[model samples]
Target chain A: MAISSFHPPQRTLMGPGPSDVSARVLAALARPTLGHLDPAFIGMMDELKRLLQYAFQTENAMTFAVSAPGSAGMECCFVNLLEPGDKVIVCQNGVFGGRMKENIERCGGIPVLVEDPWGRAVDPDKVEAAFGANPDAKFLAFVHAETSTGACSDAQTLCAIAKRYGALTIVDAVTSLGGSPLKVDEWGIDAIYSGSQKCLSAPPGLSPVSFSDAAAEVIRQRKTKVQSWFLDLSLVMGYWAGEGKRAYHHTAPVNSLYALHESLVMLQEEGLEASWQRHCDLHQQLKQGLAELGIEFIVPEGDRLPQLNAVTIPAGVDDAAVRAALLADYNLEIGAGLGALAGKVWRIGLMGHAANQRNVDYCVAALREVLSR
Target chain B: MAISSFHPPQRTLMGPGPSDVSARVLAALARPTLGHLDPAFIGMMDELKRLLQYAFQTENAMTFAVSAPGSAGMECCFVNLLEPGDKVIVCQNGVFGGRMKENIERCGGIPVLVEDPWGRAVDPDKVEAAFGANPDAKFLAFVHAETSTGACSDAQTLCAIAKRYGALTIVDAVTSLGGSPLKVDEWGIDAIYSGSQKCLSAPPGLSPVSFSDAAAEVIRQRKTKVQSWFLDLSLVMGYWAGEGKRAYHHTAPVNSLYALHESLVMLQEEGLEASWQRHCDLHQQLKQGLAELGIEFIVPEGDRLPQLNAVTIPAGVDDAAVRAALLADYNLEIGAGLGALAGKVWRIGLMGHAANQRNVDYCVAALREVLSR
Candidate 1:
């Protein structure tokens, strides 16, 4: 069967992730494929690690991108840190939290989930209670920003509580890194994972993750081997974190890493704090415009992720139809509510390069037209 | 902290994998990033599956590209197929085979290894004997082309032996897919994985994998969940195999898939057999030139992979120095030996788009110049 080269339609990506990759990042992806171990590529990898440390606001020394997407990043944390029969106190606020539970279970770890409402942040009180109840829980895991519901949990507080209990904290920063104020080192996050597509505005595939020294020490002392040979950090770090001579773990996604590097470089140029403010500023603009259209956010104002706005779908409105109209009429894309929130909300994203006045105006106008129809 | 956009040096990649990606594929990589669930993107995914099917020469409906590298692809096969305590007759002829064993143990499956010398093909007799010794062995895994040592095993013979033993066969076709003859359905291979970087002329991220009906059945009937949350075929299939409404799994590497699609399209235009012949013909050219420079093939001639030339470094010539000079003076990248052959051999790749008369001539000339020094 003869098939031609694919030319994807240009859509204004205002979805949960993969939000409007800049021309620079896309161009970087098209650069010549390099050998994974090439000195020049290795040099670029070092720069990439430094940039990731900057994005995550950490100097953890173990920050690097997982070869796969954010889902794999979540798995990386669980598999490396938890052996069979290990206990973790996990907080579930939205879709990603449930996914974390899956990862924990798949790692053969007992997950004592501290449940919360879908659009609400992880209650620090409940997390504390859960840890208090399961005093043997060695890890406390939670999402900093729930992409599914656009809720921003109190990471600093949650981490502080975990630390008080002598438990390591694994944070899912997929929707928070480079889009909001996520201070990994300051919050004392034991481990964290983020998505390149979400706030970095790179093509989806690579997952940027970081680990605290405590988490590293735990992995080092683990009695059992990490279940995933591919996601094993001990082997992975030999390739990513080594100096002078880097051991080959697997052939890295050289071109995708180039895109990630360029995206991180863009994040560097804009500056992390400025990038966070840009996302917050644009969210306010979109919020006002959505207010004019009688749309309401499902997440409360104080605990919302500015980059991912989970707004309630109007009564009697067709979720699929509205999203289709946006795509067909305006070449725009918005996320349908995932998991429990399905059909109830639309996730309008203002991430990275897409967090600008033009996209905000375009998205709001498109939504208004679609809703009017 | 200061950083600039990474402008990589233009080098001719004649390494083990990440073989020279064509301009068309690289241009496709630079194309606009589309949302993972975009209808247009879904349509592209369908075409991509068909292309992968064509490349693997399989009619299996479950064929698709894994979002990670080849190593992850290997893990996906192992985790999905083997339940804990299952016995797999694994053949180790080179580096990837050893990696497969690691994956087997990580999945809690017992790997009964059938060994062969590193630079030699996996002996089918030894594989048959292993199955004979362990009649309970239900799985047989081996690499068709050993990337580490340029040894091309007899996959057809090995699969036939496994079929005789009533075992499912898993084949690693990473370095063999487009450059050499590989017929998945004809060989009755149950599960096979290949990399986009090798012979496919794509960037080094995606791994194209196919599962026969039998392999798919094994995954379906498995009682335990696949240990890898990211690599689980059951959940992964919901996203990849769905016709109308694709379930969101992980965000696929969108732009990288664009490059993979374009590379496969180019493979389609140049028929698979013709491409295989081109690699073989170029190998002959490179072989003759290497012989002129007093270099000897490490693997016996017949067993050697045409796309990857594993030749002995000239006596008294420094392996690092020659490879370094090739990069420094000629802007050429040939792979240094891996594992057991580390300092003894150089892996000169003639794979995919790099399998041309000019590249063969350039690589041979560069090696000759460095060796003479």
Candidate 2:
């Protein structure tokens, strides 16, 4: 049977990511399409790089958005930096770090793992020890903020540890880039990737990424070609370089990029530190409300990500049932726990445009109403 | 400097792909964002698979849109099907065909070349002879419609030849899906990938791909892990499978899928055969108009893709200047020939929503005025 046009419901998105998009971003997304190489389009692309650099807190010339989602962005970092038989130390605190291991193994790199519990942040001491054990390791990789659990690692300390070990740093900033404090330059992160949907609150297609000059050099000096042609940064750079003339790569997700551009523009307007503070402020309001409802967070106070609240599911509260009620009755969508945290916690997100008092109070009121019954 | 919201001009997109998107599809794209795992979103996704099956003219359960662009879709097919050291006959007639060879080699598959000149269809006789020489060749890969050169190959005959040799067919339908007559089941194609921006008239980002049951079986039994975690079909199918409960793969590009679903609905409403015929009809109008202006086609009439017309630049007519004037003065966009045909041909596309009498007239008139000036 032929399907007609899909009209999705206007749900209040407080999920792990894909936080509520703003009106401005949606309007920008609906703009008329442009050829990827149109002069005007190219001009917009140049502006996009400047905007992305500002959001990422990096002045790296190689910074740009990956055409796919964050997983591809992670692959771009891995494939470009690590060639066959290369040794790297990886910190696995949540789901994404495991994905990084898959990328490493697939690209013929050996991963020396520094393990952490599901809801806890990566221990920098353990990461340093892993590098110490594998002295020949050329890279140290970790997630800046684990979306599976709302745990923010100390990226500055991790990068410093890697630097001490004479290794470059690869950071997964998918859930933290626009919602929290992410200073790519100050943190000395060599390579990083973030999702457009998370914190950026654009559509869920593009992955913004950046590489330091030292990281770009690693890619240039690689002995083997990048395994995935689509994720190959060497070829991708020809198109995204934003110099005099842009080479044609794949069709840039034109409309999606427009949405991302708008999101970054909003980020710039709010000021990076201000946006981070907004998420923190809203997170505190939600926390107090949840506390009144007798909820306890899974991650420790100091290590937790303000943008993503991971609270323990109350005893015998029926996790799926409450979530279903929230969706069906309140039109509010929260996250189910993933991986090891499954059925144990509810992830409430206050990200980007969704990071405001109105959303936070609405979420708490909705949760209270749903949970009481 | 901070960039504000991007407002792309409404250009008459007559490019090779990213053909003009209609107002309905753009409106669908701007609809309220839903969580990727929202129940309503899943229902829409199920509907999407059904509509995609209608568009591809197949009943394969594996039919769905890849969250990335066409190049990633191309990689998805290659990575899933071609195991290490597999011998495949790659027919190179255009830029995409050469990309397939890169995919093959990158995946450790040996590519036996069946060379065809750019702007020409793949030769079936040479393909058969090549297969005769390499009886162990497991796959026959070729482009059904070459976007770079505006040539159309006989997919039915090519698939038949591959079937006769006990080889599977991997067809590049990136430019052929809705704008041409492509019957996946009738032709016994093992795998096919297409771009939403091409004949579907959806904004770019998603690549709709389908796999025969036999092809799916090959992926299920692969000896080695897929090189790129993002392009891995085994994991991707977990989310796109439209079953009772979905597994989390990567976040689906929610908004882009909405646009694709709308485009498929429009195709279904118009009727597939009618849409194909409409493109052909518009091509006739464009062809006659271009001929009046003494514009000669790069591909022979018999082998040309009606949706994309590759015409030679008039003698001493500066290619870049004419295109620039067309864009600046008339707000029209056309494709310049890529790879071997660059600077020699202007690819005039009558694709999807852009394939209409009004657009054809505007394009020809714009060219005539630009050239006269």
Candidate 3:
């Protein structure tokens, strides 16, 4: 069977990640493939580790990308740190948060879920109360930026509460790392994971993860062996640590890591706070245009994520039809609501390289044209 | 914090895996990122699905890449198909087959192991006898190419045995696909998984997997839910089915899929028989050169893999020092044996684009130079 050469249309990506990869990242993806253990590649791996430390705002030595997507990052963090019968407090705000609860249960951890409305952010008070109720919980897990609902929770406050109760914190910053303020050290976050596609403008394979010293100590002291050998950080550390000698783990996604390093390099070039500000600026413009088009935002103004915008479907409009029309007619892509809020909202992402004035305007004009018909 | 650009050395990769990526595949990886659901991207996804079908030599519609390494691909197959209390017969000849046993227990399935020595092929007689004893087993799993020991097992005979017992087969062709004959349909193999890096000449982020209609029927008829949310094929199939109406699973690793597609295209261009012949020819030359140097192979003739040649280290030689000397002096990389064979054997790979006269000459010359010191 013969396959044609791929040439994708230059569409404006307003969907959740993969947002838009920069030209630099794309070129890096095409860069020459190297053996994963090559000294040059290992040197680059060291730079990637440092860049990840900067991205996650952590000083943790055990920082690197998992050779998988954000969901695998979730699995890596959960399966490695939590053993059977371990108690975890999961705060469910959106689809990703619900996934955290699922991971906890699947990893043989007892999940004490603190529920919130689908479109709203997780309440810090509710989390504190849950910790009070489940004082024996070993860790607190929550999403910093809920991609499905475009709501940003208070990760710092959540981590503070967990630390007060002598528990570790696992933060899912899949959509927040470069779009908002995530201070892993300042907030005392024990373990944090992010997606390269969301706000790093890289292809969606590598998941950047960081762990504080305390969390590393806990993993080192685990009573049982990590269930999933593929994701065990203790074994993977030998490959990614870049300190002394490197050992053979699984073959790393070498080109994908190159793309991630390029994306992170671009972020560093743009300046992290400036990049966050740009996402906010684009979000404001997108918010204004959507309001002009008679669409309402699902998330509250104060809690809304700057990078991901969740807009409610207008009455009598076919949600799927509008998205389909946008894709077919305008070549603009957006995300449908997930889980409990499915068919009720559309998630338009203004993330990383995609968070620009041009894309915001194009997405806004395209939506208006599609919905008007 | 400052970060430097990634510049990988142009080294000839002749290691066990992560073989040299073709320029066409690298170019495909640099393509612009698109939403996983964009129409143009979906069209490309259709092409990828068709290409994967050709590579696996099957018409299984559920075939697609797991967005992780080969190990996670193994997990996806076992976890999605086997539920708790399910009985599976795993044939362990090398590290990967032992990994299958781990996956079985992690997914809560009972494992019946058929053991063979590390440097030997899986004894089909042992597997058939195991089926005789455990006729109620739902599935049989084994590695087609044992990467650790460079042994080639009789997958066709094993699959035939499993079929006679009305059991499905899971074959780990991670190191064998595209290097040798792999007729998924003709052999009646139920489920097969392979890594892109081995012989596809792509990076290692994606795993190509295909399932028979019979295996799909079992997944459809499972009594309990698949535990891993990310690897649940039901959700993944909705996105990767190559249909116009693609559901949102996790974001696909866009550029990596492009690389996999391009590699498959390159394979088709070379023709499977020609590619297999190239590997055989190169392996013969490499064997002659090693024989001239008084080196001995681990696996017996006819059982040895053409792509992965496992050679026993000289008794007086320092394995680590010699490998380090080769890396430092010549920038050539070769595999040190894994698991039980570690420090005892050197695995020389003639895989995909790395299977050539130049690579064979370079590695042999480098070994001779390094060993003389």
**Ranking 1 against 3 by lDDT, winner:** 1
Task: Look at candidate 3 and give me any clashing residue pairs.
Answer: none
Which parts of model 1 have CA positions greater than 4 angstroms off?
none
Docking class of 1: high
Residue lDDT tens for model 1, A233-313 = 999999998777999999999999999999999889888889998988999999999999999999889998999999999
In candidate 1 the C-alpha lDDT for residue A75 amounts to 96
Using all chains and alpha carbons, the TM-scores for the candidates as numbered come to 0.99, 0.99, 0.95
- Give the chain B TM-score for each candidate: 0.99, 0.99, 0.98
- Candidate 2: regions farther than 4 A off: none
Q: Measured with DockQ on alpha carbons, how good is candidate 2?
A: 0.90
User: Which residue pairs collide, candidate 2?
Assistant: none
Error of 2 at B16 (Å): 0.6
What CAPRI-style quality would you assign to candidate 3? medium
lDDT of each: 0.93, 0.93, 0.88
Write down the worst ten-residue block by lDDT for model 2 chain B. Answer: B1-10
